[model samples]
Target: MECKNDYLCEKQINMDKLFEYSNRLIKETDTKFFRYMYDEINWKNRMIGLIGPRGVGKTTLVLQYIKQNLNPSETLYVTAEDFYFVDNRFTDLADTFVKYGGKYLFIDEIHYPNLNKIQTFPYNSLINSYSLSCQF
Candidate 1:
């Protein structure tokens, strides 16, 4: 199932444009670091938690994986800090992503205050590949 073009807009991001940004980001981030995460990640029935200090490029690594391995239509990349999230529930967004055939979900800032509430329910209830990370 392909994601509707409007879904990106609803997220306040242009999917095509974000893909282009991702391409450029691929060249900018450390290839070695991304390769390490790629090799380490189980990618099947696994939850990954990346904990590191700020500016250590954890978010970049996640974006690099999405940019390299999956089509934008098949993924949803979101940061908890985004204002849209104030009104939109994380579960709702996950549900939408699953309905539109999203396979991989990359969520940044998992250590944020309300994250525990979001993680209380089983992510498999919405989609698979529920990979999360935070800057510690």
Candidate 2:
């Protein structure tokens, strides 16, 4: 279901749950290892990837950045495996986020089902957030 009133984009996104989750993670101090990379990352770059075995602070690093610099209005963070992705396509979500003037998007665990759908998305639309910036 889509939001009826567009200005209050609040209705479009699950802001309440998102804030609760984001706040919980942001309160903790940054991790000792790998956390340093967060600051070093060129968030402005169009694409970034973190490849490693599990247990690293990759997710935490991104979440910390979101909590530190971005508010719900400017950024959106979601895992590829999230239920929200089941019914909705990522590109569609990007469109809606752009419509509401979103600036950042963070997607974790990108190796989810239907990875090919991303290939179908228009290349430009992929980072419609050209002005939007986020680190992976």
Clashes of each: 0, 1
Candidate 1: stretches off by over 4 Å: 1-35, 113-120, 124-136
Flag regions of model 2 displaced more than 4 Å: 1-34, 112-117, 122-136
For residues 1-136, what per-residue lDDT tens digits would candidate 2 score against the true structure?
4556874455366544554454566556374445667779876665455545456767777767666667756676666666667766767656765665766766666653334345754343332221223422
Which residue pairs in candidate 2 collide?
Answer: 129-132
Candidate 1 overall lDDT versus native: 0.56
Q: State the weakest 10-residue window (summed lDDT) of model 1.
A: 127-136
lDDT values for all models: 0.56, 0.57
- C-alpha positional error of residue 91 in candidate 2 after TM-score superposition, expressed in Å: 0.9
TM-score for each model? 0.60, 0.64
Per-residue alpha-carbon lDDT of model 1 for 2-119, expressed as tens digits? Answer: 4457765565343344334434654565645554666676555444666666677677778777666666666666766655467776666566556556666667665454444455
Model 1 residue 40 lDDT score: 77
Best by lDDT: 2
Each candidate's root-mean-square deviation in Å?
A: 6.4, 5.9
